[model samples]
Target: LLGTVLLGARRFRGGRNPQPRRAPPSPTYRERGDTTESFPLDFTAVEENMDNFMKQVKNLAQSLYPCSAQKLDYDMKLHFLENSSVTCNDGTPAGYYMKESLGSRRWLIFLEGGWYCFNKENCDSRYETMRRLMSSSKWPQTKTGTGILSPLPEENPHWWNAHMVFIPYCSSDVWSGASAKTDQSGYAFMGSLIIQEVVKDLLTKGLDKAKVLLLAGSSAGGTGVLLNVDPVADLLERRGHTTVQVRGLADSGWFLDNKQYRSTDCHDTVSCAPTDAIRRGIKYWGGVVPERCRLAHLGEEWNCFFGYRVFPSIKSPVFVVQWLFDEAQLTVDNIHLTGQPVQEGQWRYIQNLGIELRNTLKDVPAMFAPACLSHEIITRNYWIDVQVKGTSLPRALYCWDRSFYDNSRNNKAPPKGCPVHLIDSCPWPHCNPTCPTIRDQFTGQEMNVIQFLMHMGFDVQKMAQQQGMDPSKLLGMLSSGS
Candidate 1:
């Protein structure tokens, strides 16, 4: 059955978009604090006009260049967890998709990203929107495989031919929780068990024979990859796959140790600090901290949940892909210091985050930290185009992967320090201009309103009037480089 699936999948040829031969000029932004803050005369009229203008721009752009990636079809089949006992958050069976193709005896397992839930209210809210993800019945038979999961060798040269496993996020534990707790609210946490069962089943299906393995995840899933990569590799090695060259890649999972953000309320009205969420998750899920991390931190086991603290103890070679000014940190995480006109302190905090991140991964094999405002990168077009010092992110990653897989001990190590591909400028200059005008695949609306406002020369006062919002509130949102 596996051979037949691979043979059939080989017929589907995926094409890659040509890389931009020449780099575009670095984007320019107006000097901050240059313009005066003044409200528009008519708030309602300005709002309507701006909305209509944005709509027209989005429509025109969509007509000219629809997202070509979304149009392609790939032979990806969703398979429910074979063990009847393994289940997801609503007691539904857990599931994953496998796209088998002819290539090396390698495997690329991608853990899907969705933030975790701590309590029943959080779980219930997540369930409402993620029903399709939580249940196998609603799994899409065919998915457009793009980004790291792209089936085309031209696009994803690393593991295009290797078996691809797409594990859906349903357990809400970052795949690290073990003990199941049933409260009066009937919430169950079984992420760690689900991962164990999934790995066992994959080994039976040929993962045991894998010569190369890349365990990767984005957002919360990225956290999962970091926490579980060493254990997963150990599991495979114990199963007689010791020769497998195992590596891990975390996309946008470089969560910081900014506990201060927890005090501030997030856009969702929840605690903004990820540490707070981690603490709750640990309590409810009965998750175990990595032994090395626990030993290092002694009594502060919770510190292990932060990527900065965890990276030092990670034994395997891992690559971290993140943005210096991550959108999630600014918006969803609510790390702002002042309400309006972005105080100097807030900017300092963002810069400190970058410095801390660089210091944390100083010894890692590779890192791609672009100075951009966006969150995720591996799954977007930016993965190919975003450049630093004349080297595109994909090219840098390719070079690093080559060095990582090199078996020639005689060859000198690529470099002792982390091969960081980072952008020098602040995120405002690197923000993708097309983001504001482009229509979102899910929302079918302009994806970035702040970018649009900035591009169109709209000031904070005008923006506040147009949206019927306070100027201070708008300024705080703008401070994040939204």
Candidate 2:
């Protein structure tokens, strides 16, 4: 199945766009929280738009103008901070990858996401297992960008021309630590200091003249953005770069502080218990929180790690992009089975998770929340496919960017169709037609190779024709595992 899907992806990348044997069944919708009433989901317009977009993608693949040129200078160079005090968990010098675009004053600095280790036991275990994350010794000299970091204008329309910086997660601190290697801990954790040093270095490399600076991250990095967005802005203010309009874009980071579906002992596993782990991690990592948040929680600095707790304290304009049913959160919360044949109680729990997320995001000035069960956005090739209310993430982000500038200047609402606060109020996961197909290991409804390839932008009919088989027959055989 994987092989067949890869073949289709390769063919599509080669610029072929064949029609499918048939369009998938039309979707059904219900008013949020209204169980009795059902509505017909009209995807006629959406399909037309998607077809046009696929055509655009096909054209870009064939021409490859921006992609070809982008490849020439998109290799981000790795730079170790000169400040010796800033180091990764293994005492290795902390570093970030930078790709400078000449003639562009806008900057997008993205922090990479890797789940953190809060205590000495987990940190030690992390070093032996995921050494590359804990140390910078094996980081590549040059790395290419993708998703939002992509230099290609076709893929990343919003900030494609901007100067891009990719900060790897190495401190095991979620980019919030301020401690050095101690005899007792046996490791340095300077995640917070590393970011400050990176900014200071960029001052010499044209950041001083930047008109717009967007700080973005996914998962743990997303949480880091919430914890550090204001500080980064204040850092620039202190350095006299007050003209730089700093903003944040957090992806898949708004974790709910809700209870687990199946409670387990804190010592059993960190993946199944986040509250206890975070509580212990704050002290072990010497984590720093924004002043307002620290004061709000007083003694419980760990609350800063949760988006709902810290978002109220953020002063900068931030655009949040999150999956309504985040897979990572479900795993940690012990809500593992989300596929078909879901138990009654577990399904209710899943629905409630989406409700909680919607309620929390209601007050956020700018956001795009889809009714899906996945993690990480903004850096995916198919980000354009996922939309809420017919607005793609890029489109929503563009509007949010414009709204920020407009409101800051004249206090006007966003333009006609540009909606920044988009949340799917639908009850269940994958209710949105634009939502990606969910693949659960334990589900009875696993996608066949044809469906998988189709989701990946392949022409199923073309694949069937090339194999000298009828598309319908091929699908039948694959379905029966013949």
* Poorest lDDT segment (10 consecutive residues) of candidate 1: 40-49
The per-prediction CA RMSD against the true structure, in angstroms, equals 17.2, 15.9
TM-score of each: 0.70, 0.78
Model 2: per-residue Cα lDDT over 1-482, one tens digit each? 23443454455554434434444333552243235322322211222133334334334444433333233556889999878778999988888999987666789999888888877777888899999889999999998889889877678766676789999999888889999999998888888898899999999999998888999999989988998899999999999999999999999989877899888876523464777888888788888999989999999888999998899989998989989989898888887653335555776787799999999999997999998878898888888789897899988887777776667669686678878889987655665667775553554465644454344344547657967999988667545533
Candidate 1, residues 367-468: lDDT per residue as tens digits? 777655567777664466666655666556656665644434455556443244544443342343322133443455664656443443446675479679
After the best TM-score superposition of candidate 1, give how far the Cα of residue 50 lies from its true spot, in angstroms: 48
Instruction: State the displacement of the C-alpha of residue 207, model 2, in Å, after optimal TM-score superposition.
Output: 0.4
Deviation from truth (RMSD, Å), model 2: 15.9
Candidate closest to the true structure, highest TM-score: 2
Residue 54's lDDT within candidate 1 is: 27
